[model samples]
Target: MPFQHPKETGYGHVIERYVTRKDSDHPRYLELGSRRVLRPGWPHAERFTRHLIDDAAAITDVELEALLAYEWRSRLTAAWLIGVDQRTSFRERIGDLLLASEVCYSGGGYCFALARLGTHADAEILTAYLDRYLPRTDLRYDQPEALGALLRLDAHLGTQHADRFTEPDGLWDQWVQALAHLQDSPDYTPAEQRRWTDLHCDFASGWARP
Candidate 1:
């Protein structure tokens, strides 16, 4: 959607107004509740999220739900927005948002959002979900993308379930290929490789340390 400031003032009002804006030829505008405002493009997503952080108090449960329900592509945008909002206090609040549902638009966006938030106390909660929900044959194409997000988060947050990736299945190859493409350059961190090694010991172990 084309960028347009809300006619109304205040972060909440601005988000609310944006939500109500009629869909145009561009991507749809999403009103994620009183505190959250989402535009179609990644740039606009960043801008809108910055606006929300400026007025964090306005964030509400309704907006969180809207974010969770967001489609996968949009969820990635939402993830970026949330990552920018990283705050210790927001951990509990964001965890509450994820608690509402498990079946969401699973994509790179959703993965990042969950991973970013997973760095907080909420990480424990999501770790459980990740342990239980991950490694499925379904979403095989998307598994690498999801695993990349999880590995990054595990690296940052130190998840106990890091070893889950080390399974002998082709998951490691998938992870290597996925990480190579998902990131700008094919570089893996020690922590990142730890998760990879846990999944594919031979492949990760053989690689020289970066």
Candidate 2:
């Protein structure tokens, strides 16, 4: 089947389908992620997030865990948008389903979501993703999204680049340090955060360039 961006939301909002592909090589094992997101410019974005948050709050602990594990990447940022710090299994469930989720399997665009919930295992997953979906060859080079996310996570965790993900030239180390500085500081304002996110979205969208 041709890959389609269905306009379904957690609620009943109708979104225009995102750009679709005709003969995509979708992963056979695609697992679902957080259903919090709506169409990119949907008018009901806030309502969608609120609905999911309320739905999450009313569910049993089991359901909440599923909600958190459902990060369509960004660790499913909306959950935290409403402050899931006190929600059941917030940390425990985040990224727990990576091995089973098809988010990264789809392509580099989805892999971009890894940074929000970045972990050691996710780093490994991206490494493998690059190898499989964007691998390098003497005559072929793939522009992988793995770099940006890896750099951001290294900063978030305040750590040097992991050896497995590192290239021999130490470029990853310098890049990670620079990205860490750009991270939201104690004084970073909400407006600044929005700008940063907008910039990120631009860069991420460009990753679609072939």
Candidate 3:
């Protein structure tokens, strides 16, 4: 099924108000959330992660949900906020967004959130996403991250839920075969062992440090 129009997916007034803010009212967290991944070695990456995490923590659940309804930038930051806080209450909704795959760039955040939640339910969601999207070789949306998250959950839960996907002639194998140029490229890494490291990891590290 195709996605609903962006105009129809979100609360227009709410998203407009949130996205059009000035200075302090603006959601700086959205802009800062990806800095860690984009500039991993910069001295300020950790600080940016900490600052965004703090900002995310300050957002209300209603506000966060509204952000999730908006475009990729807002959805990405909202997912990070929800994940960092381990708000399992939003897990189903986040899972829906992951399966929706409505837009690019935000799916990794959804995968991150589900992985942080780390429940059988979350694994199911990631599995469902892979089950649906992995076979579609034309679409490159978050397959790596979703698979990474599912494997992470399997590791944490002591289960083999990811085996079906990793096995020979599996969806993953088919997906790799579709990547014609990248098939034997030395630079290509399989999603099974790939780590979708992003802002959440940096925030966790910043908090864990004494």
lDDT of all predictions: 0.41, 0.35, 0.69
The TM-score, computed over Cα atoms with residue i paired to residue i, of candidate 2 is: 0.34
Q: Top lDDT: which candidate number?
A: 3
| TM-score result, candidate 3 | 0.77
Best by TM-score: 3
In terms of lDDT, the poorest run of 10 residues in model 1 is: 200-209
RMSD vs true structure, all candidates = 11.7, 13.0, 4.6
- Give per-residue CA lDDT, model 2, range 1-210, as digits (tens): 222222222421111111111112221111112222323664544444344334334544433333333323222332332122233234333333332334442223233445434566555554454444322222111122455444555556665443443554343333333445533453222233223333453433332313
lDDT of 2: 0.35
TM-score for each prediction? 0.43, 0.34, 0.77
Local lDDT at 111 for model 1 = 39
Query: Which is the winner by TM-score between candidate 1 and candidate 3?
Result: 3
Model 3 is weakest, by summed lDDT over 10 consecutive residues, at: 17-26
- Write the number of the candidate with greater TM-score, choosing between 2 and 3: 3
Deviation (Å) of 185 in candidate 1: 15
Write one digit per residue (lDDT tens) for candidate 3, span 97-189: 998888788887888788888899999998899889888997678887788788878877998888898898788878867978657654334
Error of 1 at 20 (Å): 7.6
Q: Which stretches of candidate 3 lie over 4 Å from their true place?
A: 1-40, 186-193, 197-210
